[model samples]
Target chain A: MQEKDIFNLLTDEGFCNYCLKTNADDVEYWENWLEEHPSERENIESQKNLIILLANETAAQVTQSEYQKLQRRIQLSKKNNRKIFPLIMRWAVAASLIISLSFGYYFYHKAQNNRQIATTISNKTAPGSTKAILILANGQKIELSAAANGTIATQSNTAIRKTNDGRIIYDGDSKSLLYNTTITPRGGKFDLTLADGTKVTLDAASSIKYPVSFTGKERKVEITGQVYFEVAHNAAKPFRVLTRGQTIEVLGTHFNINAYDDEPTIKTTLLEGKVSVNYLGINALLKPGEQASVKSGVSDIRVKAVDTELVIAWKNGLFRFSKTGLRSVMRQISRWYDMEIIYPETLKNTDLFEGSTPRSANVQSILRKLEVTGHVKFKVDGNKIIILNK
Target chain B: MKKGLDYINEWDAFVQAENEAAFHELYCHYFKYLSFIALKKGFPVNKVKDNINDLFLCLWEKKGQLNNVVNFHNYIVSSFLRKLYRKENLEIDESMFVETVPGLQTYPSVESQYIAQHTQDDLSRILKIFVEKLPDKQKQMIYQKFYLGLSYKEISETNSISINTVYNTIYKALEKLKIEIGKENLSAFSLALALLSLLCLIYFQKIS
Candidate 1:
């Protein structure tokens, strides 16, 4: 056999398979054939050498940035883990507070102790609500009522429609030109519409500034709080949302933007269509079912696969909690119920939750359901929800 | 407590309890060669770094539970390849959404069958790199044979190439590779090569 023939046989799956199976006769035959081809000996040696070279290459090295990121993630994970204990302790304290206040109220009323009754009433009163200021582009302050509902304004020929559904919509001509801003308190939720007919549902303690009409080449909006957007289709005019340190630009898509000022990262989740997420100097093109998060001053964006429904469950009128902590859960409750959350430091540390409740349901009902799960217990007196040890 | 100690210890633990420093030393010593392999395999610089980091992390995480890993470098290479495959699969899933969502309008499931773990050892990486550098026809032939693990008959059928040409190209590729690495330590090189060849044989034999 020629050197080429031997090489071919070595590369062939059948020959390799035969060799692997330890077919003595085939090996003998190949060896004999190679012995007879003296001219091809050099070529055979080279083939052997090449095989060795191919086998010796090592694994790739990790980059410094990746190492740093991993280190940071480890640190953050540790920090989060540490915080879990404190949150639990806080829950314990809150539970004690609830018990004392309830007993005090009962004793004071039963004894007709007027002085004690006043002090106990003051102690049991709900914590202060989150105060938010809405600064309109026209320099006007709208002190939004906790019970405010319906259309707030008409700008740039578009109606700034706020629905009872806790959403805002901009319904008007695509050519109309006006912009408005809406701000929400920590314990509040609001909805808005964009000029180009995009519906935005802002989570508690969030704010957004958007024009009444998308008259320019692109529909752009600035956001500060968490907002879910169902963008209207206009391929000619791409929709762009700027939040904190990241920018998401999409051409007719559905997505959610969570750029809360206090959060360490700006997360953009693409529900449908293509979006280019620009953060930390990197432009990552994202598709549906993908989420990208950018940290402040970090040039790298972390991309991960996620379920879109889980991210936008708030807009769907369901408080779909997935592996969230008690503090996060309370934060969401405080917004919708418009109540303050005060707890001992330890209660803040516990972070496992998975439940769903209708947004329209009263706070007491929601807490009762949570109690059934045995993961959490709550005491409700009027608008305040006291976290209890489960 | 040190910057590189954790990684070194992890690597040492993979080989033997006290040998983690050796693993770290090897990792740092051969960083360039490993990077070359990653680059040749089409991994961007950033991703290559991540791949290696993940490999070290995995080693550390699985240290106490690991069995004897034959040929540590080959094992690392295989792990890296699997990471690259996973990353690529994710990208493909993401791209599928973009292509089919609006204009194409096909509700293709984002899931792919290629999500399975693939461990192509060091030899395979070297072979892939060499084959990629070959001329179009040569590269295709090598890919069909080695990468695709095709038989001579299959290669002949796929590209209408004579069995003789298939053999010749494989011979030439092996010879070129041997010459390139011949300058290094001969005995250690030979052992590594032989081990790799055996590994490839076992891998493809199972697949085929």
Candidate 2:
């Protein structure tokens, strides 16, 4: 290839898709071309690096809120830098010994793809997309995904509109409070804006019920499965989320609630502002960056600090698993892929998955990653994923 | 101007004058690189983010001593790696003979072509067969040099092996991959030709 041709390839989106291995056809074409033109290897490599670097930098852009959190961490570390210098020195000496021993472990386990399995199948179960069902108070149903980008429905003088960008908005005023429920089936999700201006994102296999207008003293919504809320501030009226056995009351804040019935506990994670989580007559106040977990049939609510990003990873289009168990991981995959997981009762493993992947990945890609652990295997038969022990 | 020169200028401003803007520029430049590297090395994202902030804070505080550093890119990268792995001699002087102007932007892309594709399902299946067949020591050497983007000298230091062994292992493994891929493509080409000829025969028979 000519130098100019190489430059064109560097700037081409096809080349980027090849570099990231996102598109299979692009990858095949590039690999074949590289094999034919060995002389352009150096140029190809450098350009590929530039592409990856650019992509990485784009993915790593700190949001305005995240930047403030990072600045705080840096400030705290600066204050403790001097005091911790000698201590870090002593710890470094001890850590080096452990590191040397662990170096072999890290190397051996880094690329451990021992048992290769066939991943490419003719049919693929794609990841979830924007789709949901809206139920009006009068038992009328609107399939929001197929509805046009305009007023889909109206309830009590409130204009229910669907934006072109796939968001359901409730505009205008309502004299009477008529409730509406938005439900997302498996392999589907939807975004909604309540009359009070609270923005809500419904994850797959989830539902949220809210009023057409806030005529009462408070804005309340009941949710199932997982939902993220960014409440519009109203000092006079408190915003409340009723989920299963727990109730979360917030004055205007961002939070995520994972209250799937299959899950062991209903977790309400607060991202911004304050909230009070009530479970079984016990109330636990939560500050920003805190989580309140209410277990089934338990009288008390446990509060702890958590990484809110991981809590709302679904809303951000990411599957971030940090020491998450196999069963839990499979549950997430099942919801996203809309597949039934069939595993034997005798199948019990203690493998903790630790990785992150984009939610836009296919079922095979997700399963392939899990297979890299060498502890589990998956056989995708039509709409079912059968987990096998290694 | 090249990206390396931009990085070098930012490094100089931060080290010599303690310019906060330049320091922030350098931080933004390497933050994702370090974060991705740490994550690849199996560090949790939250911990990696915290460690990156701490690493930059310490480097900022100690910028006075960072002057006179010849390769600012290598210095910052190796320092972070050493701190991360808790090993002292993770530095690579093998690329010392190369022109210093090119800086850090060149090496990370060298062998990551295959390493970057290690995540794709089909590509990784092919890599698994070849990489799993290699000896343990050679596999580690290839991984350190290619996947981790470490230099030969750094690999030798990390694995306590000779630089010659690191070079030979990586070189042999890469050659094997090239040969294997070439042979596979040759077979695929022949198969395609055979199928095309068969189709031609069928067309001629139909016309006849």
lDDT of 2 by residue, A88-178 (tens): 9899989998998799788666646532333343344888999999999999999999999999887779999999899999998898978
Clashes of 1: 36
TM-score of chain A of each: 0.57, 0.69
Candidate 1 residue B140 Cα shift, in angstroms, is 70
Candidate 2 backbone collisions, by pair: none
C-alpha lDDT of residue B183 in model 1: 41
Best by lDDT: 2
lDDT of 2 by residue, B41-147 (tens): 45544565566766776786678998777667645654565465443234322111111211123323444444455434433344456565666566555433333
For model 2, the superposed segments whose C-alpha errors exceed 4 Å read: A1-124, B1-208
Best by DockQ: 2
lDDT of 1 at A272: 87
Q: Over the stretch A1-390, how does candidate 1's per-residue lDDT look in tens digits?
A: 333553453444434422222234544665665688776555444444433233222111122223456556546655776879689889989999999999999987877867766566643222223234455557777665443667676554565555675455567774654566777766556555666667776777788877667788888889887888888889898888888867888888889988876566788999888899997678999979999988888899899999788788877777776566667777777766667666754662353555455676656656654543324567776666777664
TM-score per model (chain B)? 0.35, 0.41
- Model 2 interface CAPRI class: incorrect
